[model samples]
Target: MRVRNRKGAPEMMAANTQYVVENPEAFKGKWAEKFGNDHPIHIEVGSGKGAFITGMAERHPDINYIAIDMQLTVLSYALDKVLEMNLSNVQLLHVDGSSLTNYFADGEVALVYLNFSDPWPKTRHEKRRLTYKDFLKTYETILVPHGKVHFKTDNRGLFEYSLASMSQYGMTLQQVWLDLHADTDFAGKNVMTEYEAKFSSKGQVIYRVEAQF
Candidate 1:
């Protein structure tokens, strides 16, 4: 997941500011107003390259989407994809996931997505994982009652750790698919991220889970 520094990445992001919100904090508690609709807001943390978010937005026009990624280089690519699609229901933000609550009000989000997020393999960095207990607490603060987190990963170790962490945190685990593509109920409806497509093509088992608070 090492991203190469693309020259003029910042400038490119700035040029595409129409789709990329420069100050996401300004939209706190007013995301529906910002979208000019009362549609539910769904956010994708670490939305690398925008494939999944953009696709979801396209397919589900009734829902508004905000794709957040910290790296300007990677986010710029996502911005380009949004612009290319001319999608009205989707927006991009260059921000860290750990500080998500700062830009979103309590219960402002209906659902959050974590697709192929960095696993943070080292035991010392467990807290940095997106599905860690601390991060799940942060998500709980922003989500409404019964709000859910839909997570998918290609790594088994990370998936197992996330299942245990979410359960331990007292979140309600609803649905789980140890091999998503092999699950008939979800495979057809599931939208593939860039990583998911690549990994699944190589016969990797994708794990998915839904947890509610």
Candidate 2:
């Protein structure tokens, strides 16, 4: 699905330099200083809107959250929500997920979230998948020892592919849910993204997995 580009999105992002990082690469290995504390940093790669990342920051005050997206228009939406909530623990980064290593040093990030990422279903595009082995290696590089990745998606094929990719990369799967909403025990533990809420409302099954590297 193509996101409608919003007018003034670039200006909006430019005005909010405090919450929107202008030069993320300059802060490599120094994210704790950027957050002004050593709180565990959790990032949502391909964070579509402000929903999941901002919600997580609100729930976990001790954890710093960074929302990364390549689309400036989409990131502007997230910026609006962060400012509306006056969340000090959240930051927005306008960068591609594939360049994560350029912005973070080894053991800098504690956790990662891949929510409803593009499947890149074409056989020739498999390497573009977030769960691809090379991408997994990048995640592994920035993640702390035993750091985990939490992934959610409505697409069955992508979920299956991600599961296999993570397993092949020697990641330990901590939890797997074929129908997350059907699990009564998972209530209150899951934070629904904009896409997750929309798809799940249509009676679509949500798949989730937690894998540790």
Candidate 3:
């Protein structure tokens, strides 16, 4: 497992701080116990270099944060931030987002964030897309009955694909923005990912939504 040490990311990383974990399996079943609180757990899947999740963790101490990514190199940078910020309420895990059920008990998570996930647009790679129905089913199992998936992306095809998948999984899209930065409340409310900041800075039109299963 090659961990990503993200010294190559642009200056935009300066503002986005987060915690990263190297070997996440060591902390299994300890998230609730370690946080030592019963706050709603909001998890960010595919959390890159710890930007968005970390920022959100810092902002919302009342909410327990768990950021999962398979890439260890980049994840370490995130963990470094947790140590820097001394956040007792945040946790990081290195795992496949597609294999969500392995980590959580049924109805354990309150919210799930999917930001700039791999589009996996090749027709044959549909199964690998994180928002595919199979993955949604996995998420539904771990998420509470009221749990929701908050997704953001610059890929139009994946965004549309996700919309269809969400509906197929018996989810209602609650809030959606075709152009996320159009003075929309979503842009104000969302913690932008590292790739999101780069895409948005380049005037990319990001599509986003909240879906309940």
Better of 1 and 2 by lDDT: 2
| Residue 15 displacement in candidate 3 (angstroms) | 24
C-alpha lDDT score of every prediction, in listed order: 0.91, 0.94, 0.80
Give the Cα RMSD of candidate 2: 0.7
User: Highest TM-score: which candidate?
Assistant: 2
Error of 1 at 80 (Å): 1.7
Predicted candidate 3 versus true structure: per-residue lDDT over 84-107, tens digit per residue: 878877777767887777677788
Model 2: residue 57 alpha-carbon error in angstroms = 0.3
TM-score quality measure for candidate 2: 0.98
Q: Write the per-residue lDDT of candidate 2 for residues 65-104, one digit (tens) a residue.
A: 9999999989999998999999999999999999999999
Ranking by lDDT, best first? 2, 1, 3
| Per-model tally of clashing residue pairs | 0, 0, 8
> Which regions in candidate 1 have their CA more than 4 angstroms from the true location?
none
Cα-based TM-score, every candidate? 0.97, 0.98, 0.87
Q: Which residue segments of model 2 deviate by more than 4 Å?
A: none
